[model samples]
Target: MNYQTFQPHPDLEALIKCYWTLEVPAEPAATKQRILPDGCIEMIFILGDDVKRYTSGEEYILQPRAMLLGQISEPFFVEPTGVVSSFAIRFYPYSFANFTTTPVKDLANRETPIRLLFEEKLAADLEHAIVNAADTQERIRIMDDFFLQRLKEEIVIDSILKSTIDTLLSAGGSATTSSLLKGEVSKRRQLERKFSKQVGLSPKQLGRIIRLQTALKILLNQPDESLTSIAYESQYYDQSHFIKDFREFTGVNPKEFYGNDELALSSLIYT
Candidate 1:
């Protein structure tokens, strides 16, 4: 398995978190890999072979070769159907809204092909460019060129949505939405509506996912960190609360996750 991440171009730094790629050699036996939410959105291109995303034990679907995955609220399962090689763009929670008008909430937990999001011809051309590129850097140039074009359109991102996500991310999801704003009960409701349309999840839900990402990063990097210490660092109320939230997002306890073979993809990507 090989995983690497690249910084975004200077001009796109505010909207994009980073670009990433993963390559895993083909194996003799297939294994289901668990994927957890990280409080962001991604545009993925499968450059090697198809991958299967399971909806249940007995059912699954092939992920689109070039597609967008929106804010994920729960853990999901996926396995490689062949050699796994993919390149993707990770966007900050509220920034993808600048690219299209598609209600982000509608894309939750699933992917939509790029063609569906852009004109068929334009999407096809972009995919063609990436597929025909000689290497990863070339691929990045292709992707960057495409987004740079979209950037010129000058889409408006809602101010409340931007500052709210900034607070959630900066605080590692520790701050409450109410505290981020002034007195007014209805203000929270209004923010939720914009968040759903623009960021794909309520402010509270996005916060939880971001918090889990924080804890997951600690576990992945510092193997010696105790669960209790992780909980405190992530600002969970208690170990129980931390365990409950971890289980909710990852479908497993921290102990099971530490050395689990099934988490190879998760560990490699998050680490």
Candidate 2:
């Protein structure tokens, strides 16, 4: 397996978090992997083998050759049909809406093929260009060009929303909306509505996901840290609260998650 993340072009940094890619050799049998919420939206282009995304405990649907995997509120499972290679663009919570008129909330928890969101001809052409790219750098260039062409001048993002999300991210989900709004109850309510339309999750939900992400990073990168220390560092009320939230998003406790095969792909990508 090979995984790596590429920094977005300078001009696209405000909207995109990063572009990432993965490749895995074909295996005789399939393996299931758990995917946890990471408080971001992604565009995934499957370039090698097909993959199945579980729709129910025993049911699944094939992911598109090019698709947008929306903001997820829960953990889910997916298994590769065989070998896999893909390029993905991870966008900030508030950034995807600037590219599409589709209500961001409407796309939560599922895959929406690019055809459903873009002009058919353009979407098809874009997929072809990316999948046929000669290398990772070429793939990144293909995506950068596609996004530059799709950039909109009329789509406006509110400064308050970015700052609020930034505050939550920097605080690792410890900041409250009231604190973010300085007790301005009206704007606080307004922020929730705007967040739903643009971010696909409420501020409280996004904060929790961000907190969980912080903990997961610590767990992956710092082997010396114990769960108690991670909990405190992540600003959970206590160890149990931290474990509870982690289990809710990852479907496994901290100790069980470490060195877990079900989490192999995610661990590789994140680490």
Candidate 3:
């Protein structure tokens, strides 16, 4: 297995987190791998054999060759059908809304084909360019051009929404919306609506995912750290509360997650 990430062009740095690539040689006994939420959206292109995303036990669908995956609130499973080679763009939670008018909430937990999001011909052309690119650099250039074109002359990101997301991130998702809003409590409803459309998640939901990601990174980097210390550092109320959120997002407790073969793929990405 090989996994790598690249920084985005400076112009797109605010909207895009990074570009990533993953390649894995075929394994005769590949098993379904669980994927946890990471508080971001992604545009993925499968450059090798198809991969299967399990909808339920024994039921799965082949992911689109070029697609946009929305914010995921729960854990999901996927398995490689053969050699795996994929390139993807990870977008900031509040920034994807600048690229399209489609409410981000509509995209949650599902892979929407690029054709459905953009003109069919345009989407097809972009996919063709990516698939035929000579190298990762070429693919990155193609994506940069495509998104930069779609970017509107006036990028209207909500100031409050952006600030709220920033606070959550900087505070490791421990910041509360009420405190962020301060005296303007009436804006809570409006903020919720804005969050739904721009972020594909309620502020609380994204915060929880962000917090879990923090804990996960600690677990990956410091494998020997006790769960209690991790929970405290991550701002959870207690070990039980931390375990509850862990199970909610990852579908497993910290103990089961560490060194689990089924989570090897997820571990790689989180790391």
Candidate 4:
């Protein structure tokens, strides 16, 4: 398996976290890999063979070429179809809304073809450009140009939603929905409606996930730190609360997560 990440342009830095490419040579035997959530959404372009996503015991389709994977709230399994190579962009929670008109809330826990949200021709062209780029530099250039063009063509960011996101991000996921909306539940609901339309997850859900991500980063980087200390630092109520949230997102406790080598790559990608 080979994986690498590329930095995004300054204009897209706030919206996009990083662009990445993954390549795995065909194995003598078939294998399945489990993918866990890290609180973000991704736009993926499959350059080689297809991959199957399994939810429970059933298989979910990840069509060849390109797709948009919504905010995954839980873990899933991926079975590679022979040799696999792919390019993907990881977007901040609210960033993807800047480019598409599809109700992001409707895309959760599933992968949909890019054409469902973007024009079929444009999506195909973008996938081809990303996969067939001459080099890493060219791939980065293509991504930046595509996003910039999309931004210019249709940038309809709602101010209240943007402000709410700003608060959540600024607080490092510590801000509550009430705090964000200045204690107005009605306004909070209104914001959530708009957020659901574009960003998918509600403010509260996003905050919780963001908080989980913060704790994960700390645990991965400072393995020596105690769960109690991490809980306090991450602003959870206590160790029990921290453990509960961690288990909710990762299906494992903090201690086990720290010791899992297979999850190391996932932790790095997410953080």
Query: Which candidate leads the pack in lDDT?
Result: 3
Please provide, for model 4 over 9-44, each residue's C-alpha lDDT reduced to its tens digit, 9 standing for 90 to 100: 998887898998888788777555657765578988
TM-score ranking of the models:
3, 2, 1, 4
* Predicted structure 4: lDDT: 0.80
Clashing residue pairs, candidate 1? none
lDDT of each: 0.89, 0.90, 0.91, 0.80
Cand. 4 TM to true fold: 0.88
Q: Each model's number of backbone clashes?
A: 0, 0, 0, 0
Q: Estimate the Cα RMSD of every predicted model relative to the unseen true structure.
A: 1.2, 1.2, 1.0, 2.4
Ten-residue stretch with the least lDDT total in model 2: 149-158
In candidate 1, what are the lDDT values of residues 44-154, reduced to their tens digit?
999988999999886999999999998888888998988999999999998898898787888899999999998899999999988888999998888888888888978
Off by over 4 Å in 4: 25-32, 58-64
Ranking by lDDT: 3, 2, 1, 4
Better of 1 and 3 by lDDT: 3
- TM for candidate 1 is 0.96
Q: Is candidate 1 or candidate 4 better by lDDT?
A: 1
Q: Write the per-residue lDDT of candidate 2 for residues 1-271, one digit (tens) a residue.
A: 8888999888899999999998999988877999999999999999989999898888999999899999998887989999899899999999999888899999999999998998899899989889788999998998887787677445676798999999998898889888989889888779999999999999999999999988989999997898899999999989999988988999998999887888998887668
What TM-score goes with each of the models?
A: 0.96, 0.96, 0.98, 0.88
